[model samples]
Target: MTQLALCVMLVSEIGCNRDGLVICYVVIPPPDQQWGIKLPNDTWTGMMGQLDRQEVDMALGPFTMTPQRASVCDFSVPLHHENFAIITPRPKLQSDVLGFIKPFTVQVWLLILTSLLSVATAMGCVVWAEGKIFRHSEKNIVARAFLWVFCTVTQESSHWLPKKDGSRIIVSFWLLASLVFMSSYSGILTAMLTLPRVTVTIDSLADLVSQSALPWRLETGAAILTYLKESKEEVHQKAYRNMGPTIYALLRERQAVAEGKIAVICDETSMKKAMDLDFSTTGQCHLYIAQGKVMTNAMMSLAFRKNSKYLVQANHRVRILLESGLWHKWIGKQVANSSHCLRHPRLDRREGIQPLNLESFTGPVLILLTGATVSLLVFLCEHLSHLYVQPPKSTA
Candidate 1:
């Protein structure tokens, strides 16, 4: 199903074979082997063009199942199915510079701060309303309420609580909410710091596009380009627009992907071959296959001229290769001839958490340094203001 040599097996299965089977017809290849299927009436031609014009009985090699291709020629029952995948640079551990805030999003942090302020304001209002009915100190109740909220969020036991029903209710509900917020934050942050939390690797097309500079491209005239161009999805349309005119000859561009310059999208077979070639050439996996599939339920099959008498025999042969697992065996044998790069990396490798290290504390340490710098600036500004103050001579 994958290798050109395997096509011999398929050809044999259609009519003849070395297993004492006799041939009824001879096989022939169209002049252009690397032709892409053009829209039927678009006045374009390729491998599928040969089939369309009745120049070839069947076309071999991996091809994605699409409605357009189906209308032009009949595909045998899928020898195998493959989804589009991406090859990008292996993601290294991202810098933990913003590690502290990574656990919560900006909106989340803002909401948390808002919640604290809102609860404190509510409690302060309750205290003020109750001040007339009860006998308690009323000085700096706002500041005190703020302190209580802060301490509660930090899980610090507050030494005092307002002794009023309304204020107590506000505090009680906030306590429950804060418990959930703290537990989630703690669990996430702890997992981030104590366990190896791999940066959310590029797992999808959206993730790849999120990197402003990391545009994705495939070989010129690839079937995928047609898919991208005609796709109605916004991201797919955007990708097609942003892509450059890169051809397969631009091996350097693909190498750039290994260096994290850009990403390349390919059908499953091409991607597997590229990975295997990398493993064979360098003895290390330099490319990373994204965890997400670009397309699903894509069939890889041999194409036959419509209403060809051999169609039923080809379908039967394809089913045999698939059901018997011989197709996978041939694929594996071909893959081993080059190198064995696992289909994808181990999922646990990106759990992101590792043993606590100095790097893990980068976010907290940066916050502390920022606070200290601000405190120093405030101290300087205060003394400078004192020195510049005019004497009270005018009042005297």
Candidate 2:
């Protein structure tokens, strides 16, 4: 309803014959605008009357389906989904990683907790190794401990190990600590590699609430907001906002806006990206969908005034152009070419996404080296301890 402010046309000559005869003129719609145009209702009402009389070829705008409008004009199947949202403001916060993990499902929460635990365990092992080996003062204990962690976990080269003359027990413990660190790190890495990545699953407004108590956010001008507000369930469940300022506030706060608390109010695609779905959200979020069951999944068709088969044929050609998948292929290549555009730049790039090197380990060598190292260290510790620390002569 909002995209019909002005009209212009391009006139061109038709034939190569020496005679100059302009055959057709192509009318172009005006630039898009939201508000600030003034016109009386009768002006548009009269235009529609003329359109019914075939005085005009067509009118294009956001014209949703209704019985009255259908009587006067034919409509194309909806081009996309026009789902509503409940937008609200985000809140301020300090760094508590648990805030994100706590509201999710068991699997999601487990992954988050496991990551934290791995980091904590690695830090602990490094601290133990540093204290046991280095004669460094406790004043610089934290710095040295972190350096050991940096070298060991990442397998970086460092000359930090104590001389062989140092206490054998402490050396043995460093070996033990390294084994523990690698085992724990590798276990988590394996779990991650084996699991399939998550994708966007929420499709409908109802699905949002069904999955969790996350609040929905809607913009003031969003067409779906009006429809959602009319529905008793949606109106009660969702929160509406004028813009992103308030929406961001609720998201950061982790509270539902319905009860005047902050929560994330984003479209499904945005949610998917935040949750690491298949692809990043970049294209159009709003869509126009046909309501009737028969037209469900139907391609959005362009309508023409009655008895104009030419326009219908032209629309069909456009549909064929769209469905050929050339556009999809082109978009995919562009994204791959700029792989940096995707999230997790350091993670694996299975899609030929450019230069970010994935975490590389020679699989067989890594596994064998890890196993042999752990076994050698454990056996050496047990054998040496048995030989040196003799059972105290029973003073019997």
Candidate 3:
């Protein structure tokens, strides 16, 4: 789409008739032969090499603009700009039956606990001072205050509320805070149990490189590999170090990612293509593009041989197409073609309407078993003690 638009722009700029303009693709079946322009000895190689040899007038695609690529061929103003998106297996769903605790972080839970303890202690102390220091009729004021506060935590009704204004004020604030916690926790936990909980295992390029869980691969002869190999940054260096063997084709490897065998480091174009193809073909979305970007400096433009006569005109035409919004429209059109499967981003999210089954609630099942076992043990111990205390009142 972009190429056709650029072709029309070029023709219009030169005031040449549409028939006079010619566009041809140097077709190569080998995926490896289509990308990267570098090699010691080259005789009519990939698009980059063909550009360098001046065999082809221009090469198109998201031809990444790098210093190494720039030294061989002149690039028009970058037409498409992007960073590589990591494609990996979705992180496993958390069925931690105790996932009820997950609605709040550890710090938040601790804060709640601290607040509860502080309020209970203060209530007990204040009540103690009132009954002990002053002539107030009270029995076990400290124990009763603690019990009332504990009961409040469980939402249990109690008749024992403080009579004094200061005590009542403290209780009121505690009630408000507890209500807030309960409302938020219940809403979140319900949503969690019903909806899919997506855990973004890899949020950045560094996260992908630092983790050794899944072996990651790159496309053979990709400029991303070249960028990583030559990059001075630690994350890129580590990514290069940890990169698995390169594959000529990326589509076949999508299954590997789905099966949790490997991850693919690819640009958004390839990522979306794979995702759409997988979903369209299988009717299931097993692949996901991570939210991380590998290289933010990557650019796409028309690649012309060094000092090619068309470089100046091509840049002008490219600029006109970009400014006129034709380029973005074409890109958007291409992306919109795969509108069928819209996989939510982050940790391989599923459709929002997927209802979890009993098997999925492994955490809750385990809790139930533990509770049953504890009850059985307590019942056995109680029976044993009863028999010891009153010998069953001998039948004889």
Candidate 4:
């Protein structure tokens, strides 16, 4: 029987109802992998995608039943829900550091400022180079002059322009100016980019490793763990060769942080769970390295063969799941209880009793207001169109 019909039938039978039978095959995602496993089509979209494509009967993992996804596939009355968190090596500062930064860290205003500064500086330099002083200089108006100026400003050598009389004066001063401005500009750009990297270090496992060189536990074959082991092996390190698969037995198996283990495993949401569990890993985790590090999040969805009824049904299911309040309930469970909070008074203060505003309601509220304005305009237009089409009611 199709997983969809089977599901309906199961639900129906359990509820003491006799319904018509409709059997259909469904493709299910195996729970073997962390992010959704791949189907025969060689695509992975987590469990939901597998089910939508009929690759699997239905995805039963802790798939997020987002409203957007519901428009594509049905989620089975939300299995689990959690918030995203980054785990890094513990910071050197007091535990309240995150509490402080969370309020006013690098925000949209900061990004906009940096972008404006970079663009303005780049344009200013370009304009200065093309200005009257350099343009009206008594040097020969050769293409080589332009190339020389451009190359010098960008810190590249100009092989075509020799050290001739006219080229000497212009080249010397221009090169000097470019060096000073370029150096200053570069410093600012570097600082802007590195600030976020440093702050978001907790977001990546490698960043944690670089910051703290302690052994961390990870499930066998996990992508993050695999990447770490591969990189470590490439350097021919003997200690990491086989430091045993598990971490200190005292730590929770799925939990990244606990009483004994120094690190945590699982996706971003799981990190939040650790804090919710009253685990004390927060404030300690830090970025693994300061340079040449990289990490990416998981992205996948259900597959479909063009337009199909199954696809439509799957999307509808996703919508219902998201709107049903199951996802939020799941998240509440993960964070509501904290063992650590009860044991340590100071830790509770950092976490605080005040509720967290997870979604940043400002953006969505503005968007909703804008949408309502547009929708009102559309409705007005439709009403006017209907009146115009009715040919002056009863004038005849």
Candidate 5:
């Protein structure tokens, strides 16, 4: 049995005899010496040491079965399987200041702008040709063309109308195109603005290594470190290299994660405990377990002294417990009884509906201001040009 209460309960339940006789000795190792690691002094410590000396009949905890450890002791059938994962702070809601523009990518926005300009220029040329052939006033054709295009984009009525059939046809096509463009923009923008944007910062180990903005660490003496160092995968190598040099204790790592100081790479079981602790205290689930699994089939089993007679019985009983779904039932009950901040994270209430600010309307507001400024400049330029052309007519 280990000092971790969950591990103690699990092991105690597994070791119970059919005669209702519970005859198992439990040893609590020093806090820093829970798992055995061979020291430079040619001596082992923790549960493995106690088992090696025949001081304890069995060692039970989240002890993973490694080739090195198996050499010294026999393992019972795995009580549970776990994966390596990263525990990160829950992503914050993205600022809405420039969120309105998130509906389309930069290339898309540029394409739309290019299309608008091309159509406006084509319409202006068509209008100019009609005026030239029919000898009608052709003044301000560019301005009128742009105004018509703007109105189409905004779905607003414009005073200017195309007289000729050819120009009308062009205008008709532009209106259809504008309708589609506007509809897509409106739909996408509404969804982006009204719905909260949740971001997963580190989805995979590769992502964890590539993103240098967040410092990441692992608890000292973690089993996953050995896996990372020996992994053939390039991503794992990179992640190992990028990990912070200073190893953190479990509580220190959890605190760092909660305070947004660092992200931690840990096993799923430990991650869940951290999450439970966080939720219980803060009344919010601030920690998120990354989706990526660094290593799978990491079997956790009870360790016994080499060729111990109890190994056979223990393996059989544990297998029975697993096959009968008792282990899963216990795990489910543990999770269900654990306090959670949200029943359904996606559907749960968020920091209520944030009041919409001017920043939230940045895209449309900037467009309106830009259009007004351009219109004012165009009006001033036209008035000045007229005055200059009229010369001294009033004086004469």
Candidate 6:
């Protein structure tokens, strides 16, 4: 699409009909040929080979400009500058009611519980000692202690009173601590419930390499793979080494990604094409383009055979098109024509404040129901025990 738009613009600018002066040539299954290595086969493949053999006038596509390829074939001025991107399935949004507790890890929650228990135990011991020494009226030491602790943590007033100076001092400190804890928890929990959190399954090349379960792979003959293998950086080298067996086609990689089997490292154009197709078929956009570009500074240009007569003209026209921003405009128009699912991902769609559903309150509702059932059972057991221990009054 980019090449076609540029060709049209070129013809208009040059004041010549498309048939006589300028012709658009396309190279499919991009030769995936890079400068450094020589394939084992005698016959060469891709645009480089065709250009070397003088079979085509010009090869159009996202043919990147590299030192090795530039040495052999003359390149037009860069048509587009693109950084390699990693495409992975969008992480699913968690809907479990207990998901509200996910902001804090299990260890953090355990620590909070331990602190609560310790504070309650300390308060109970202090209250019992004060009542024993001072003769204060005290009842249900353990239950009252825990109730006081719960009320303090919840920032609610408690009826229990501590008479001794030591007990009062402990309570005062506990209140201050509870205030801080409760305030922070409330603020964080509210933000979590209001704006749902979604985990990023894959953010960068390192992330993809570290999580080996997903088993990432590159398309066969992709220039990015060559770049990764040849890169001197340890991170890029490790990422390339971690890649699973090379998949020969982009369509296969797209299918694997849609099925949640694998992730593919590809250029933006290929990633967009796969995402568009995935959205069209499933009516949902499950793919996500990761945060940053892998190859920071990469430029793509048209490849012409060595010493081709059209090099100067093609270079001038491509430079003009790029300078005028026609390339970006054409890309925007293409993306605009895609489906809404692709343009606006489902996870990002927040039309308005959605009403809380039953699922949203599942954890709290279950806790309420369980507590009620247990309380009823305990009441029945206590009543039965009382009847057995004390004989009922005779009507005599």
What are the models' TM-scores?
0.68, 0.31, 0.69, 0.32, 0.81, 0.71
On the 0 to 100 scale, the lDDT of residue 200 in model 5 is 71
Task: Give lDDT for model 5.
Answer: 0.74
User: Candidate 3 — what's its lDDT?
Assistant: 0.72
Using lDDT as the measure, name the better of candidate 1 and candidate 3. 1
lDDT of 2 by residue, 268-372 (tens): 222222222112343311111111111122222233456653455444433444477543353343334223323332232344333312222234455668899
Model 2 lowest lDDT segment of ten:
6-15
Clashes of 4: 39
Off by more than 4 A, model 2: 1-56, 59-72, 77-223, 235-237, 240-299, 303-310, 322-396
Residue range 85-126, candidate 3, lDDT tens digits: 788865655555557678899999999889888899999877
Error of 4 at 245 (Å): 3.8
33-98: candidate 5 lDDT, tens digit per residue = 546655567555667777767777777665778986777778888878878788777766554656
Q: Give Cα-based local distance difference scores for all models.
A: 0.74, 0.38, 0.72, 0.42, 0.74, 0.71
Local error of candidate 6 at residue 121 (angstroms):
5.7
Candidate 6 residues lying further than 4 Å off, grouped into runs, are 1-37, 40-44, 96-147, 154-160, 164-166, 172-180, 242-256, 273-284, 337-347, 350-396
Poorly placed runs, candidate 4 (over 4 Å): 1-56, 62-207, 221-256, 279-311, 338-396
Task: Put down candidate 4 lDDT per residue, 1-396, tens digits, no spaces.
Answer: 112223343333223312445444544434543333334565544444455555654443334334444554544433233332234333332222233223333774365346434443443444445545455333443444455556665688766543344435555555666677667666754443233212333434334444444454543323344344445453223323533364322124434343334444444444444445334445432222112223333332333333444444555554454478554454555545433332322222323333335333444466678999999999999999998877655755
Q: Which of 2 and 3 is the better model by lDDT?
A: 3
**Stretches of candidate 1 exceeding 4 Å from the true structure:** 1-5, 12-33, 39-45, 49-57, 65-74, 102-188, 200-202, 206-211, 249-256, 276-293, 304-316, 332-359, 391-396
RMSD of every prediction: 5.7, 17.3, 6.1, 29.2, 4.5, 6.5
**Candidate 5, TM-score vs. the true structure?**
0.81
Candidate rank order under TM-score: 5, 6, 3, 1, 4, 2
- On the 0 to 100 scale, the lDDT of residue 210 in model 4 is 48
Q: What lDDT is reached at residue 40 by model 3?
A: 63
